[model samples]
Every structure is written in C-alpha cells, then in structure tokens.
Target: EHKRTNMNEAIVEKLHGTLSILRRERDEVHRAKELAMERLRLAKEETERMERTLQASKQKYDALMAQSTNNSNSNSNNNCSNGSDGHGGKVNESVEIMQLKKEVERIGREAKFQHMEYVSKRDTLAKLKNHLKAEDAQRSKNIRIAQETLKKRRAKLANIQALARNHISTDGTSGGSASRGRANDNGNDSGISGGAGKGKNRTSASASAS
Candidate 1:
C-alpha cells in the first residue's frame, strides 16, 4: 500500500509538471498568434493602399493619353497655320504617360504580393489555433487525472497513520511481555538461593552434633 501511495504521488507530480508545460506552450502559442494577426492587419492595410495608388495611377495615365490625342490634333492645326514644330512637347507627354503606366503596373504587383502574403499568414494562424486547442484539451485531461490521484493520496495518508498507530501499540504490548518475563526470572533465582541457604544450615547442625 505504501508503494502504491508513492507511485500515486509520483504520477500526480508528473501530471502537475505536464500541466505547467502545457500552460507555457499555450501562452507562447497565443503570443505567436497575436503577432501573426498584427502582421496580417498591417499587410492588409498596405495592400489596400497600394490598390488605391494603382487606381489613381491608372486614371492619371488615361487622362494623359486623352490629352496627348488632343494636343496632337492641336499641334497639327497650329503647324499648318503658324509653321512651328511641337515635337518636343509630344515627346515629353509620351514619356510622362509611359512613366504613369509603369507606376500603375508596379503598384498592382505590390498589392497582389501583399495579398498573397496575408493569405499565407492567415493559414499559419489557423494552424496555430488548432494546435492551441489540442494543447488545452491535453491540459484539461491532465488536471482531471491529477485530481483523482490527489484523492487517492489523501486516502493513503489515512492508511499510513493507522499503520503507524498499530505499530506503536504492538511495540508497547511486546515491551510489557518482556518485563513480565524478566520478573519471573528474578523470582526463580531468589527461590534457588533460599534452598541453598537451608541446605548449608542443616549440614552445619549435623556436623556439630557429630
């Protein structure tokens, strides 16, 4: 029974340790999840801003293309009327239009990339959530087992006390028996001494009479 109690206590200790580890892991997982969510939110906001920039660039590019068409027509009429060159203006307008188009494309690519990153991180967060759920389940199970073992330990404590009392009582009984045995031995020695003294006295009287 004592051995069983020791084993129970060991199991309870192990379960307690396991609970502590699980709690630490749970806390770590929660922090990781929170960090991931913060990153995702920032990424989402950035993606939206990039998309808005892309749209503005597209609108500007379209306006430049329309203006280029109008300027070309106006330059043709002015060249016919005043005999002047407008090639430099056209070249600068075309370059501006091209730059705006490129900016639009670049912004679009960046928005798409940020979106993909958000999706991947979101998936990772889901996995972490599932792992946290499993950890909670295991921790709860360990708690229940520990509680049961503690009850057994309490019962074992009572048994141990009872055993100690019985042991003390048995030792007291044995000590009393040993003391009685010693008294009997002392009584026998006294009787033997008395018989020897009487025999010595009888011999002395018989010798005196002779």
Candidate 2:
C-alpha cells in the first residue's frame, strides 16, 4: 500500500510538471499571435498611406497634363499670329513650340513612370497584405491546435487521477479482508501445534503407566 501510494504521487507530480510546461508554451504562442496581429495592423496602415500617396500623385499628374494641353493651345494661337511677322519669328516660334512639346513629353513620360511605380508599389503592398493574412491564419491554427492538445492533456490527467483514486479505494476496501485471512491462518496453525503437543503428552503418560 505504501509503495502504491508513492508511485501514484510520483505520477501525479510528473503530470503536474508537464501541465505547467504546456501552459507556458500556450502563453508563448498567445504572445506570438498578438505580435503577428500588431504587424498585420501596421502593414495595413502602411498600405493605406501608400494608396493615399499614389492617389495624390495621380491627381497631380492629371492637373499637369491639363495645363500642358492648355499651353499647347496657347502656343498654337501665338504661332498663327506670329506667322505673318517674318521667317525669323516663325522659326523662333517653331523652336519654342518644339521645346514646349519636348517638355510636355518629358512630363508625360515622368507621369507614366510614376504611375508604373505606383502600380508596382500597390501590387507589392497587396502581396504583403496577403502574406500577413496567411501568417495570421497560421497563427490562429497553431493556437487552436495548442488549445486542443491542452484539452486532451487535461482529460488524460483527469483519467489518471480517477484511476489513482479507484486504486486507492480498492486497496482500502480489501485491506480488512486480507488482514482477516492472515489472522485465520495464524489461528489454524496455533490450533494444530497445540493438538500435536497434547498427543505427545498422552503418549508420554501411556509409556509411564506401562
């Protein structure tokens, strides 16, 4: 009984230790999950800021394009007026218009490049968001698995405790029966010894009488 009790106590202690370790692991996983969520939030904010910047750039590009078109119309009117002045003025006007056209083309190219860059950045931000989402999902899955595992461990611990209780109870109930059986055996042995002793005395008496 003492040995069995010691064994059960050892097992319970070991299980409690394991439960503590598992709790620590669960806490760490929860912390990781919080960190991941924070990162996702920051990523979303950054993407929003980028989108706003891209929108502003697009608006600026559109305004510049409109101004360039207006400038082209104005230059055309000036050329028409200066055409009658002389070959020199016409040549100078044409050069000025060519320079203006070049400037407009350069601005258009810059706007196109800027738009492409914006698109690339947007795509990259989208991918980042997706990646963060996946990470969040994976973290959630890990937490759920951990929780399930913890539940199972608790259930196992409960079963171990129940079995231990049953074992102790059975030993307690049978203890009296075992003790009674031992006592009866001792009594039988004593009676047999006494009867043998009496038989020896009787033989001695008959021998003396003879």
Candidate 3:
C-alpha cells in the first residue's frame, strides 16, 4: 500500500512539472505573436502616410501646370498688344515677354518631372509594404512551426518518463544486482584513500562490437 501511494505521489509531481513546461512554451508563443502584430500595424501606418504625401505632390504639380498654361495665354495677348501700339518701347517689351514665356515653359517641365519622381517614390513604397507583408507571414509560419516542435518535444519527454517509471517499477528488487553489473563494467575500485587511477582499458571493445 505504501509503495502504491509513493508511486501515485511521484506521478503527480511529474505531471506538475510537465504542466509548468507547457505553460512556459505557451507564454513564449503569445509574446512572439504580439511582437509580430505590432510590426504589422506600424508598417500599415507608414504605407498610408506615404500615400498621403504622393497625393499632395500630385495636386501641387497639377496647380503649377494650370498656372503655366495661363502664363502662355497672357504672353500671347501681350505680343498682340505690343504690335497694335505705335510707341517705340513696344518692340523691347515684346522681346521681354518672349523670354518670360520661355521661363514659364521651363518651370512647367520641371513640375512634370517632379510629378514623375513622386510616382516612382510611391511605387517604391508599395514594394516595401509588400515585402514587409511577406516577411510577416513567414514569421508567423515559423512561430507556428516552433510551437509544434515544442509540443512534439513535450510528448517525447512524457514517453521517456513513462519508460523510466516502467523500469523502476519492474526492477525494484534488482537494485544491488544492477549496481554490481555497472561496477564490473566500469572496473571495480576499492580505496582507503583516493588518487587518480587508470580508467577501464577495454571499455570500447564492447561498444565497437555493437
């Protein structure tokens, strides 16, 4: 009866130990999940901010384009006005107007180029977001695989425990006999005082046979 009680108590202690290990594994998995979610949220926010900046650049480019068109119309009207006037100053004023129109056209082309640059930047931001998403997915998958591996290790540990229990139960009466066997295998030692001694010389012979 006492032996049975002792066995039951030992089993309960082992169960508690296994449960503790499982709880630790679960907490680690939860922490990893939280970190992944935080990264995903930050990446999404950055993508949205980039989109807003792209839209603002597009609006600025369109407004500059409209202003350039109005400038061109105004320059044409000034040329006509200069030709109709009889004053000697009108020819010089027309020449100045032509130069100003050239400058306006240059500014318009610069605005168009700036718009193209914004589009390229927006595309790059999109690619970054896609890459981040793929990385997040891969991280999540790896976490799942790790958790599964932990579960399998825990199961293997349980099996080893069971085998140990069976060995102890069945060999309860052979403790001294097993110790004698081990002592013979290792080469028996007797001592009144201790010092270094040669290890068993033929130890690897049995291992090599196997």
The TM-score leader among the candidates is 1
lDDT of 3 by residue, 1-210 (tens): 445545655655665665566556656655765665565556556555555655565565556556656665676687688865334454555555566556556655655555555556556656665765666566566666656655666666566668777888878859888988888766644431222332343555666888
- Comparison by lDDT, 1 against 3, better one: 1
Candidate 2 yields a Cα-based lDDT of 0.66
Candidate order by lDDT, decreasing, is 1, 2, 3
Question: How displaced is residue 207 in candidate 3, in Å?
Answer: 94
Using TM-score as the measure, what is the rank order of every candidate, best first?
A: 1, 2, 3
Residues 131-182, candidate 1, lDDT per residue (tens digit)?
8678777777776776676677767766876786788899999999999999
The residue-by-residue lDDT of candidate 2 on 125-156, one tens digit each, is 56765766676666667656656665666666
Residue 166 of model 1: what lDDT? 89
RMSD of each: 4.9, 8.6, 21.0
Which wins on lDDT, candidate 1 or candidate 2? 1
| Pairs in clash, predicted candidate 3 | none
> Candidate 3: minimum summed lDDT over ten consecutive residues — where?
192-201
- The collision pairs in model 2 are none
